[model samples]
Target chain A: MTDNATRDIEELIGMMARLPGLGPRSARRAVLHLIKKRALLMMPLAEAMQQVAATARECLACGNIGTSDICDICSSEKRATGEICVVEDVADLWAMERGASFRGRYHVLGGTLSALDAIGPEELRIPKLLDRVRAEGVTEVILALNATVDGQTTAHYIAEQLEGTGVSVTSLAQGVPIGGELDYLDDGTITAALKARKRF
Target chain B: MTDNATRDIEELIGMMARLPGLGPRSARRAVLHLIKKRALLMMPLAEAMQQVAATARECLACGNIGTSDICDICSSEKRATGEICVVEDVADLWAMERGASFRGRYHVLGGTLSALDAIGPEELRIPKLLDRVRAEGVTEVILALNATVDGQTTAHYIAEQLEGTGVSVTSLAQGVPIGGELDYLDDGTITAALKARKRF
Candidate 1:
């Protein structure tokens, strides 16, 4: 390749490398794969990206991303169960949807409170969530945040914010994960699981 | 977001998941990241992919991909060294270029011979490589093929074909990789490195 062509391809690879779960090496591999399957994969991917780029937007109600002002979960009448699942980001919300257990709605916080990063409740959708609780007559708020310290701190802050909102607040149980081996369980997880053991 | 909007986003995510090194989970995260940085990252990526899709083509001379009929490496005077590195795919050629060591041109074979898959010498650029060796006055043909069974078989076949062509055929050495820990070394790699031990 000439310098110009090589540079173009390299720039593409560099952008791809910035994506989550991909490194420079894997990005290069992906570019090659795209090139090899240009007709079948690359062209379609480019068109899809263009379409999404032109259409994708955040849900005004819940902060979930879609091709409209309101996300599917937020707009669906079937999900109007007066329950809101709070998550740190859209990825967590998508994970919850994949589980197919949550029949209500979701609120994507964008990120959690981080003292080092100077992030606060105001930086997230906390205020919007409170408004939704009152306006939508939400009866429950499920905190599905990660088990990290910052995640818990954000959950506690949100719970405190909703103290006088007349809504039930619950968090996911901390215990041995399904399919987890006892040998690989951490001390904290093992302790939590033991303490929360059921009558079974 | 209605069903139509959800379908659009889901379609994009499905296309992304088909790319190499990206699973359904990583694709979801990547889509979210792209949506988050739509103006800065996603739009440029979409444009770049579109440009590459429109203009990228294979070089008629050495089979390397470029925007022109002849690839940059093939047309460059500086890279006109008598050595011609042979690789099974464009990705290997790109990898060699990234190392910034090889100054010669390359011949991409597209793929190796796989009898089970019914692939033969005619399926690759073996004939064109021989023609280039004579036409371009190539002195050395470096076989940078993968170390798979099919790759080695293809290498040996190419070497045998070039026996009387006055071209030196060579393959990459098999041994321990740089920065690789001995504890993590596989048995085959350890044996090969021991057999090919050289003066330190």
Candidate 2:
């Protein structure tokens, strides 16, 4: 390859390697694939990326990323169930939407309260969430945070903040996951599953 | 997300899922990551893609993709080693370059002969390779195709075509790979390694 061309391609591979799941080797492979299938894959991907770059924005109300000011769930009258499912990030909200079970809207906190990272409740959407619960007449606030130390701490903080707001605060049940083998289950999960065991 | 906003995000995810290694779940994750790090990663990646999309082109002489008419290797005076490494595709050529051992230029065949796929010598760059061998005063042609059945067939065919051309045609040695365990090697590889054993 020419010097400039090699540099461009290498820059692309470098950027690709920085992505979440890709490494240098896989980025090289992906670049080769993109070059070969430029018309079919690369061009469209480039266009899609440009479109997304220009349009994608965080929903003002719930912090969900979309191409609009407010997310669909937040704007939809049908989703006004007076219950807000709070998540750490947009990925969790997307996972919940994929499940297609939750009829309520969501509140994306962006991240948990991490003392090491110096991230507090102000860094997240905690204050905004409180305001929404009070102004929207919310009845339930489901804390669907991960079981990590930071996640639990954030959940507890949120729960405390909503203590006398007339809204019931709850959390996702901790148990052995469905389809997970007992042998692979951690001791904490096994104990939680046993304690929360349901009658057949 | 409004209807249009949801469609736009979904379209981006759908396109991402069509990539070689990514699936729907990981594509969604990638999209979310991109949106979150829009200023840091997404915008730069999008710009890089656009630049590559606009400038990247196939080298006319050796069929290597670059930003110019002739690739650097093909045009470089130092690379006139009278040896041309032949590869099935541009990816293989790039892999060979990454090894940084060969001081010779390369010829990309675009693809190997596959009777099952109705591919023939004319479909590849076999004829162009023969012309280059005679015109460029080439002394050796290394057939670094894959170890698959079609790859071997294509190599044999090229060797026969260059039978009386005064140029030696060779292939990559098939044996136990570096750091590969003998127990993990297949029977065919073991036999080949034994047959081609060298004095250590």
Candidate 3:
């Protein structure tokens, strides 16, 4: 191909390679697929991405992504249950929303504290989370962070920070996952399940 | 989130899920990653897609995708070596390009002829291949299609059609792939490799 078209496509492939799951080879395959289905798939995908880029913004109150400043959950009157579910990132918040189990608002920390990466409470939205607990009269703070070591450490820090504020802190139950078999479960999960045993 | 922003983001995720090799779950992850790095990755990707969509087109002669009516390869004086490598898709053409082994241009058939899928010679760019072979003084037509049943069948059909064109018809050599172990290879591959053994 001419250098112009070739360079443009190569640049796109380079950018696509930066996505989480895609590597250089898969990115090339995807770009070719998109070019082949340009009318049906490529154009629509581009338009959708443009629309989202133009509209989507991070929520100022809880750090959840939304089109508006406060986010839907933060603004909804019914969601004001005096409870805030703290998560490491907006993906976790979306996952919780998909489950449709929790009715409370959320606090997205953006990332867990990582001393290796030089991240601290000031780097995350920890101060804003504390402000929400006091200003919004939050009675409960749910630690919905991941089970990683950094996640646990950040959760503990947040719980300790809210200790004197009178708001009760809790975490999602840890145990064998649903549909999990003991044979396939990891040792940590098995131990957690045994420790948290309950009656049927 | 409010339905407006939720719907917009959901729509983008849905469109992303349509891409090749990406399923619903990975699509969501990719979308969330894009949003998190909106300024750095997402907006640039959108712009790149737009630029490609505006310029990329199918080469009229060889069916190769390019930014112009005739691809750079077709227009290049150096690539007019009286040889054409035939492949089933643009992905295959790209794979060959990455290898940098072939000096001639290529003919992308788009897909193999499939009886079950009702794909015939007319469905692919077979007629275009014949036209190029005759008009461009092509001497050697190399079938570099996959070794699948459909691929071989289509290759045979193309060979039959070009029988009287005075053009030499050949196919890619089949042998033990590089780094492939005899213990791990299938019976058919072993048989093909054994039959096609060359001078040591």
Candidate 4:
């Protein structure tokens, strides 16, 4: 008789392979691992996954995921930094959090303005960002957009839109970073280079 | 007013840092990316995480994670190879699965027998494996233990226990792996060296 266990495991492997960075080989490995550590790692992981699924939702205002309409950051009274750091995606937001330095609220742009793809400001929540800036009396808007062509185009457009709003526009520093050597720095970097410029 | 957003983000960052292979720096970067892509990647990932946390459960028999008591693998009759490839943990089992050649049942030993650690046969699934062999009419037992000292000891002990049980035991073949060279072979490998190795 055909083995049902094999089919079932194969299905699980297929699902796991769909995850980012995991292929069929990795998925199979992961599944086997979970089975072996059922009591310690797998069981707990399953429980946690279930709990999160039941309670997680997107924050309506900022699009952050949490268990409520407003995530902890949005609901907290202390987070009103009077400035919003705007970015294109959640991955970028995660990167910023890794830095652990910023002290401001955020505005996730969802995606860049792509004319060819028909993605515009309306699709990217630009209107919502403008509303937050006006309502919150934000004095600065950090354009933490990617260094891609599309990202720059979107940034310049947003800057133009916010020009007369009395808010200062800024970005992450340019040039070789900490632990970066000057010889490795590219020609394009030298052009956008920020002088050892002063205080924010 | 104090910046509540920063504090909340920082707390989130702390939690993210505890994930496997991610440090504080990567966690910060991840958080920033999430903030930027809040509407797309971050929100969806959060939702998916929550859903999985709530629904994940371990298979009662095989320890595979699923929504029900018995994992799909254990319940499937097709996987009854009457051959259980024994492993030390789930991760190891997964690694074998990634190879995708074997099509037999599995028995996770959980851990190896260790005299120093006060671990005995009872601590592992040795008795359970014996019972399974009798119950399931298993013919071959593959000792897929690790190459570690404890792993070898456990394999030998299991072999002794199964003496006269009429089951053939086979260990994984060792040699220069696919695309591996004889010069890269370690001492153990050079010793286990077969006079006439089979060509795959």
**TM-scores of all candidate predictions against the true structure:** 0.91, 0.88, 0.94, 0.61
RMSD, every candidate, angstroms:
2.4, 2.8, 1.9, 6.6
TM-score attained by model 1 = 0.91
Shift in Å, residue B31, candidate 4: 11
Question: Per-prediction TM-score of chain B?
Answer: 0.92, 0.95, 0.98, 0.81
True contacts kept of each: 0.70, 0.60, 0.76, 0.05
Rank list by DockQ: 3, 1, 2, 4
- Candidates ranked by TM-score, best first? 3, 1, 2, 4
Estimate, for each residue in A153-198, the C-alpha lDDT of model 3 and write its tens digit.
9999999999989999999999988888899988999999899999
TM-score between model 2 and native: 0.88
Q: Top TM-score: which candidate number?
A: 3
Model 2 agreement with the true structure over B1-200: per-residue lDDT tens digits: 44766787898889878767788888888888887888899889988877887788888878898988988889899999999999998889888988999999899998889988999999999999999999999999999999989999999999999999989998998899999999999999999999999999
Count: clashes, candidate 4: 55
* Candidate 2 chain A least-lDDT 10 residues: A65-74
Candidate 3, residue B92: lDDT: 91
Estimate every model's Cα lDDT from 0 to 1. 0.89, 0.88, 0.91, 0.71
The candidate scoring highest on lDDT is 3
lDDT at position A27, candidate 3: 90
Error of 1 at A179 (Å): 4.3
